[model samples]
Target chain A: MQEIPRQTEFVEVRGRKVQWTRGGSGPDLIYLHSAGGETEWTSFHNRLAQHFTLHIPAHPGFALSTGLETIRDIQDMAWHYVDLFEQMGWCEVPVVGFSLGGWIALEMAILRPHLIARALLVAPAGVRVPEWPYAELFIDNLDALRRLLFYDPEHPAIPQALPTSLDDPRMLNWLRAREATARVGWNPYLHNPKLPDHLDRIRCPIRILWGREDRLIPPAYAQWLAERLPAAEAVQFESCGHMLPFEQEEAFCQQVTQFCR
Target chain B: MQFFAFHLMPWDRLPDDFEQRYETAWTWIPNSLYEPGHGGTLYNRYLDELVLADRLGFDGVCVNEHHQSAYGLMPSPNLMAAILARQTQNVKIAVVGNALPLYNPPTRVAEEYAMIDTISGGRLIAGLVVGGGPEYYSFTMNPTWARSMFREALDLILRAWTEPGPFEHYGEHWKLKYVNPWPRPIQQPHPPVWIPGAGSKETIEFVAQRRFAYMGIPYFHIDFFKKNFDAFREACERNGYTASPSQLGWLVPIYVAETDEQAWAEYEPHLWYFTRKLLKGLVVLPPGYTSARSAATIHRALGKFLSSAQTRQDIEEGAYAIVGSPQTVRDRLTELAKWLGVGNLLGLFQLATLPADLTRKNMTLFAREVMPQVRASLAESGL
Candidate 1:
């Protein structure tokens, strides 16, 4: 069967224009990318788009979207997403996030809990586990990324190197976006102590899926979260790492679909 | 239900004028040093209060570990456990946690835990943890290996308890031959292991099925604790067992003063130090070290929390320790316990920067005026 292209569109969010794409049709689902923006061409996103009307946005300041000057933090990003949802007339949509995107989705749940129908956070961050430091991703260090994100170093699925060279212009733009996003919200980075307070207010069902071997954010956090969020469920993917959506895409997409349905 | 208290030795004795002369004097110091009149002296008195807890008919007194952070001065909780062991006669001494992965020879944990267990006459609750992200950077361990090392260390400690005497422990992270923990714990099969988490899904499941008590250190707020308790309950149900609230414990920063208004007023400065100063630079997410769930969880805590003007007040309201009158505290604790379905309450009366006198007052009030009624109410309800 021929693969369907994701229907592309754009909307103004928080004073910046954001490019979003969609494909298939069912319940509305929003996809937020990690530090690395939308990789819709990848088979994982394509498959996700096949089942749900996947609305993946190139988060402001990321590639294909105008850089955001006023967007100061993840909450800014979260509020912008709420605006996007309002603009798209998505009163209640299941939102899925990965890595940094997961952080944004969590923020979205906290900031605009009413807008979400259901949510999934893959390889998310935020729970303060003892001494589990996030690896330094800057300075062209994929080795640190490999060691930090993967549970097993020998796991065949982890890309041995960056999918594309860092110097590549396309890769450069993505890196710049990552840095800009990090700079605005970098100091404390991916957590709100108040979030634990606001979590109970998130009326929708929330599922936090963790890769057992994820080094960036340990699975232990899921346990921490499972304890705190009342309407929350947590599942651990033993064979996966931080990149659960991509590392174990088929299983991930299937689980999400099943949960959303 | 168990009751406990904490004192993070914040030194207050150093001359205020000393800072004018020396650049380093004004620099942030560890919580261990006793301040001349208030910080350190009060801590010793706080120790006396723990002894008083034993006298006041409370069940336990708790302490914990932290390093380089003024927030928690007890770098070696084992040491505090020893002090409490010698001073207090009857109350259980819970070293609520020791950072496991930070220690080498994992046997050190096995040894220390055993020592504390024996010293306390088998009254010890060994809390093992991976020591959060900041401790990882402080101890210079690869955040990537923290979970495996932490879990392995836990396994080794558990094995040391059950496996007869000196045996080989072969672990991918830790390789120890003839692994023997001397003075094997006074409590057979090890002192009860309780896991503490700010929030972690892995911790809840691990502690729940094992029937080990799970502690939620929701430092600031009570709201999210409901979710943690709920998740813990669900995990229990999934395992075909109903989790009683008694199976869970929660740590709250509590201060009980003469009046509710006085308590909040007295607690303001210390609480600010606890939230802002001590927490500054403490938030570090280096990347690639946590599981998928962690990275996807909370992206930034400080910036998000402190973005607006009322941030400080918001944090204070959320803090488990804001000072309140005895009746108010009792009411809050009662409501919180029933809300979270928790039986054991670990009250952190002494914070990193709170004066000793203030801390002691908080404890003494809780013990003398507040606790009896709280217990009576729970007993009355058969909760």
Candidate 2:
């Protein structure tokens, strides 16, 4: 696959300049990033770009985004993205979201079903299950967090992105991302109490992907989510953890591409 | 200097292999481990210590809130304050404090504080705190909203106490139709507000702006306390007010005996237990507990302190605690008080599993032998 030349740009959405990346040319495929903040364009983005024009926006509070002050909850973030779609002139785009972003994608689907033509939620975390609670990302130390997110801690592709120093910019960005996540997903814990009730409202076709070895949110949650949604399928990837995109990059992109097609 | 006898009221009867078995003493520690009969005795004994402190002429008896933890038994400090109000006379019953944000309407805090104040006949120092990071996990609270909720809840509490009731409160975090607290506080305006902080600049500013007494958290090194006190004083100066010594309080763990060697021999094990065992793997700050700037500052400061004090000798040299004979304790405290310029001293005599008799004796000795000398020294220095 030829590498897609990606360019980072700021798009003004509801008085906030949202930083986003764009590349490739085809059907609009909006990418939502996980809680660790937006990653550098990888082989996943490269492959996806060949099929669809990838519109990946750094979630409001991550990196250089300016919407942290305005976004209060996941619902607010859903609405912000809704406005982003309209402002960017994207109509009925296929949305692919990872982890925290997957939760946001679900919210978007519920809020405005028409906006998301198709949805692929990879290891999503927004459903309240009493038996299996989401692993606490906020409380875990950096090393523990990495272990929770990856199937193999020694994987070469797995970024060794621990904070170099207390004042490291990367550290600050990580903290900001976690802060943003807490702002949205703190009460009732990373899940909307009413999400299950409103699952039927999402008319768009949905694919819930989960890593078989996912420790952060159990694979059982994906099954539970698939059961709730009106039009949904749950697929589990073997030998992968919470970070499906990074762990099984080619397979994740292929699954997303197939679902979108 | 004013002295406060503070009790953590810890459940100290952990099995010998507790450190090896449990990851932490807080949050996820099994409830099955808590023996109710033992807990009952511990509570009674702890309360007895506080009452004894009152009888011994300690200025205040402080109780704090911690949930689902062997670290502190008092989940409801206000409840403890209410009991202390009736039992102890003369001593200020300081519920230091109710975690402001944890209360839903926050008027609950207002009503409870007022009730305690009324019962205590105005001898209440209302210590408002943005509960620690571990508390957010234990209470299942959002750390991002902790500061905002604290500010909003504080505003609501103050209004509920001072403003004529039946006033509607429509804030971002809480919406209340009628915040009409029945019993207003006995203190004319309100009780003296003391806020405990772990040297966050924002907290220092917030506390200093209101001229509330800023109580330094006891866990950090003496140098950290000095730096934080200086920062607080600077914050006060920036607010165009010269901070009085009374505006600052230091929470210190102290153990006094007839001889320095005796004090160290007895206190060392308990202090080590409190520091190493009960507090192991407990620095879990819920994301967004502090702003990025504050967190960075804390991390930087903590890194330096932790690096320096990896050994017991380093900890002792840092003066994290004062354990000595009455004269030695008094001299050390006097030096600290003079250097830090803190008028209020919150002494934790009853630490993790320190037996009731020893706690009582330590309190008695400090009050009788050491307290007068410290006070006299401060007075002579015109502090």
Candidate 3:
């Protein structure tokens, strides 16, 4: 099978331009990235794109997206993405979200159930399980943050030096993304108090995936999520930390592909 | 030159191996280290020092807010200000100051500041702050929204003080229906506003625009302070105003004794405890506490100085802490004032583990021996 070339495009909603990537040729599948912000098309994105036309968007205040001032909370982000979907004329699209993105995806499903055909949440955050609370990402230094994100701190998948050089534009983008994440996720500390209560509003099929060795947020949260959602399935991967898609790339893509099918 | 005696009121009773055992002296340091009985004694001693400062003819006695830390005992600086207002006479009781974002209504700050201002006969220098990064973590305040919350709260408070408000305020963070505040401040057009900042361009510009007295934190090198003061001056000029010397203040830890050698011997341990044990890591600036630009500026300016190998001699030489004989202290301070062009000096007389007697002695020596000499030097220099 020949690999499809990814094309970048911008969608404007409420006077703010949202940057998104598109590839493959099938039913639209929107990919929401984790809090660290979206990376360039990785093997996982490429593999996932083979099964569906992937529309991966950099969340507001991340990368090329604008209007950080307007986005106050998770709900605002959910609504923004929903606006983007409506502008794209997308209907009941299957969504795959990771970490912070997973939380946004779940919020989208809850806000407008008819807009989401299915959701694949990988190590999603937002459901507050007091016993297994998420680690304080804002407080951790770079070394501690790296350790918390992966099962192996020395995992090659993790970018050793944030930017290869001082002039790298990605560095500023990454900082902006981190700041945006803090803005949205700081007060509630990455969980919505009312999310668990609204889980029943999500009418679409949901799949929760977790890294068994996740330290940022335990796999127990995945079980809790599954227990709450009316239509949900939960799975865990061994020898993986919070960065499920990167640590267990092949397995993660395969699970996502199967769930999409 | 106006001089303010500032007290951090540190709980000084840390174990001998505090640096070795604890990651930091703030936020997460074990609460068991804090005994209420010891804390009570420390508070009274600190208040007594402030009162003594008032009697000694200092212009202002300052207390600041900090949370979950031995860095400063007063979480409610207004309460301390209230006590000082009643007990002390002929001194400005500055709550330098309340962290606006931490309070829910924020009008609580306006109300309390008003009460203090009224009580002190218009002597409150209302210093508003966006609480430090550790405060955000301890209080669970969103670091990213701190600036916005702070600005909105400041606007609301100013209006409440100046604008005869029963009006409504609808801000992104705070929405108030009736913005009426009782017991309006005695100071006309509200109390003098002071803002402390660590060399952020935005802060300099904001302070300049508002004409608020900018207090520079002595966490960086003397060069950084000079640069910050120059930047503030430039900002004031750009904003079509000449910044008076009184508009700039330097907050520095000062220790004085009869002789230079004696001062170093007495102050070294406490300074070490302060710089090494109390100040550590990203605890001072959690992610998003400052804008990315300011964070980068902070990293560039203060990064090298944060290394653990920074010796007491290095700190003293860098003018982070001024410690010596009365003449030596006077000379350094005069040079600082002349160079920085700041008329106001906020001297931290009491430091980490410096006992009550020594603290009192230090304060007395600085006032009687050093302050007069500094004034004489400034006058002779024709500043």
Against the native complex, each candidate's DockQ, computed on alpha carbons, is 0.02, 0.70, 0.56
Residue-level lDDT of model 1, residues B1-383, one tens digit each, is 56776555543343334334322211234434444455455557657867877887778888777775545556788887888888888888887688888788888888888887888798888888777666754565555456678889988888887788789988877777788777788898678877876456777787778887788854525556777789999999988899876678887778888887788778776665554444444445433244434433433222233212144356445544545788888887777677777888887777646765776677778889888888888766655
TM-score of chain B taken alone, every candidate: 0.86, 0.97, 0.97
lDDT of each: 0.69, 0.85, 0.85
- Which 10 successive residues of model 2 chain A have the least lDDT summed? A159-168
Candidate 3 per-residue lDDT, tens place, B12-121, comes to 88888888888887788889999989888888888999999998888899999999897888899998999999999999987888999998899999999999999999
Local distance difference test, candidate 2: 0.85
Error of 3 at A207 (Å): 2.0
Query: How far does residue B150 in candidate 1 sit from its true spot (Å)?
Result: 1.1
Best first by lDDT, ranked: 2, 3, 1
Q: What share of the true interface contacts does each candidate keep?
A: 0.00, 0.87, 0.66
Residue pairs that clash (backbone atoms under 3 angstroms), model 3: none
Candidate 2 per-residue lDDT over residues B168-255, each given as its tens digit: 9899898889889989999979999999998888899999999899999776778889999999999999999999999999988899
Q: How high is each candidate's TM-score? A: 0.57, 0.95, 0.95
Segments of candidate 3 deviating more than 4 angstroms:
A1-4, A24-27, A160-171, B281-283, B306-309, B380-383
Docking class of 2: medium
Pairs in clash, predicted candidate 2 = none
How well does model 1 score by local distance difference test? 0.69
